[model samples]
Target chain A: MSLSVRHILSVNDLTKKDCALILKTAQNMEEISERSVKKVPILRGKTILLCFFEPSTRTRTSFEIAAKRLSADAVNISSVGSSLSKGETLLDTAKNLEAMNPDILVVRHAQSGIPHLLAQAVDCPVINAGDGMHEHPTQALLDLMTILKVKKRIAGLHIAIIGDILHSRVALSNIILLKKMGAKVSLAGPASMIPLGIEQFGVPIFYDIRKVIPSADVIMMLRIQREREADSFFPSLREYSRFFGLNKETMKHAKKDVVILHPGPVNRGVEIAPEIADGEHSLILDQVTNGVAVRMALLYLLCGAKK
Target chain B: MAEQKLLMTEAQMDKAIHAMAEKVIEDGLSEAVLVGIKTRGVPLAHWLARRLAQITRKTPKVGELDINLYRDDLSEVAEQPIIHKTDIPFSVDNSGIILVDDVLYTGRTIRAALDALIDFGRPKFVRLAVLVDRGWRELPIQAEYVGLTIKTKIDEVVKVMLEECDGKNEVLLKEHFSKRT
Candidate 1:
């Protein structure tokens, strides 16, 4: 089949076929990772613009690397360093960059649906690196890639996403992708932090981590309460960690071979215990490596490399 | 036995290749690598890479690949007794890889080549180059660097004869008949 992707504004924008193509392409890209001189020239003349309105160390750098590996010239535009400081509107800035005729625009905005709006305005393909608390499609894709590499299949796997569901785009995107891939999903967090209507996504919800930890094949821990304390989302970090964190005692309830995932900048002793994050079941580092592959697949498909 | 009539003469092939080389240079073919899809494509890749080196003052890395295992029709087609050698010495990662082929027929070969190429390393980019794109594609395939696009009927067969195999370089169209019919 021809590989053509116009825009990737949301995780929902991807169909099962698109997902399969990306996964298959990623599998192929993985071989390059094993080689000594890792690189490809599939996008020699293409230009990719990385426009970030928020601060990010991982997503921004990963995308830049991915684009460079594809042989595309990548230009980074952070809100702090760019003309946005001069009071340029998001649309105006986007149009200014669009005038340069970049083949793809990799954008991360603080507001949800900004990437969608930018995609509608520009002729070039737009990739959502992250958008507010709504979704992080690429992160989810990489996470799925990591899971697929480890487990081999997504269908019927019981995955539990623990902590801060209300504020995590990663959590939301993971739930959508996992559910679509036929995995049974469950959310565990403090009742105050879990969104009210999330049950409509067809996954079960739980307030007590102990109740659901045993049945989970994959335990994905979100960043702790203190991570969101800057926004005043939680009152006390210690109390939150005591109740919802993945400690040694709570882990005893989990299956022997349960895989653990965390979207990093991980809180050392807060949401996830150190042992679990660095333990036998940890697939965290693999997720980072897979991020490049998944992004490469996305760029290739978006750039019409499949023909 | 019917005699083989030349479809593309040596002069025509040279002229087309010269034009292709010029376009590659104009399109900034620096840091480019040529990867041929097995058997016939290997010679074409070497030939183009040599030409590109002559023009650019840099010899592009040339790699030969066999995509038999990656073919989509492996399940349908009867197994072949022997497989060809595949050798890609340099990393394709982050480099511009030009996939060279002699003829673009059903596109199944290109599909298999793609699967095989990705197994080595992801190039920074990939583009297709075909000496002859004879129309009868069963899959969606197009050549980015096309030497010629020949329009032919479903029953007609376009044969590519390189000096490495045939005595001279040329392309020929052959007609075949079934004895049972």
Candidate 2:
């Protein structure tokens, strides 16, 4: 098989064969991730650049950790400290970075399709960390790894993704992967917050949480709209919590072994009740551990390090 | 070249597995456990447990161990070794353990498997079972119960195909030939 994937721009571009290869590679990478000497010399002479136009903690740190573990030099350029704030177009900034001959470029921007444009402008591989609400491919891959670690299989499973479906790139990417893996997915939230015509993704949509919680093998609660972004989406926090929040009582309807998940900076009682988030079935911390493995796999594959 | 014939058919393999289950029950083994060593061993262990259930009217716990990292020739064989999941839902402490595998050849894989098993917990007694044993022992280890034993030279490969995976049940030996110089 040819090992040539220069850019990872969206989840839709991943085929079932591609998915299997990545998952199998991630399974191998997990062994190296657990060791005390976690660094590898696979990309010892390579350089990876991270250009984040938006603020992030997990996505940025995870990519940096992944690059460093592969023994690759990483450069972090934030818009706040870079010359781009003084009116340099994204293309010009990318062109400048290209001059340094970095082997890989990981970019995150608030505008959708920015990474695709960057990939076109550069000769090296480009990875889209998150491009607006379009897609977050690595996060979705890590989530799949987490699910497989716990459930042992992904097909024929039911996963309920609740809260802020319209604003969450995580939910969008996850729905694509879960459906591709043969899992039945359902979206539950207020009608306004759920995107219209998403049934094309083959996910059933529900406005009531009570009706959907019973059949879920995995309940993934997305972060509620940030307080600053709430004014345009929801009327009040209390009403949203009452309608969609996952509480102890609401969890009883789910399968006994159902796992709870969240992409953090949680809204506490608003998106998911605190009890269930920290409860026995939650694989939240396991997802974080698998994030490193998945990112390592992504970098290795994109860097053509696969054997 | 030597011709290799079928020593055990699919029906005979099933019968031997059931007889092993009866032996496990007659031994008065309690808290019995079956641990398979990665890829092919996992399915064999599951099959043994199913037969054990039919004989004892109780299911023995099953676990899977991946010994990729513990392999003796890991660095020499592949640059990036593949690892599979190791799942043991129940503790192995004081349990009567049966280590299952599809085929036992040079026995180095079983040696690596033994080292991997100790990391989980100490079992009361560890026994070995194989569906087919091709005679070429690099170590002194032997299977307590074997479905069939095939005698072959170093220039042949024994292949076992199971219905659960390959949609058939048979054993074959393919002669290895070097290309003309």
DockQ of all candidate complexes: 0.05, 0.08
Cα error, candidate 1, residue A246 (Å): 1.1
Model 2 clash pairs?
none
Report the Cα lDDT for candidate 1. 0.81
- Candidate 2 C-alpha lDDT tens digits along B124-145: 8889988889899999999987
TM-score of each: 0.68, 0.66
Cα lDDT tens digits, model 2, A1-307, are 2233558888888887777878887787675565445665555677999888998898899899988877789999999979898999989999999999988899999888999999999888899998887888988998998999889999999999998998888999999988988999999988888888889998999999988899999999988757438536877889888888999888878899999889787778888888888899888888888888888777766765332
Per-residue lDDT tens digits for candidate 1, residues B1-181, read: 6444567888888777777777888889767889988777888888888788889888888998867435444224332212345678887677789999998989988987886678676878888898889888888888888888978767666777788867678888766532200
Model 1 regions more than 4 Å off:
A3-5, A225-231, A305-307, B1-181
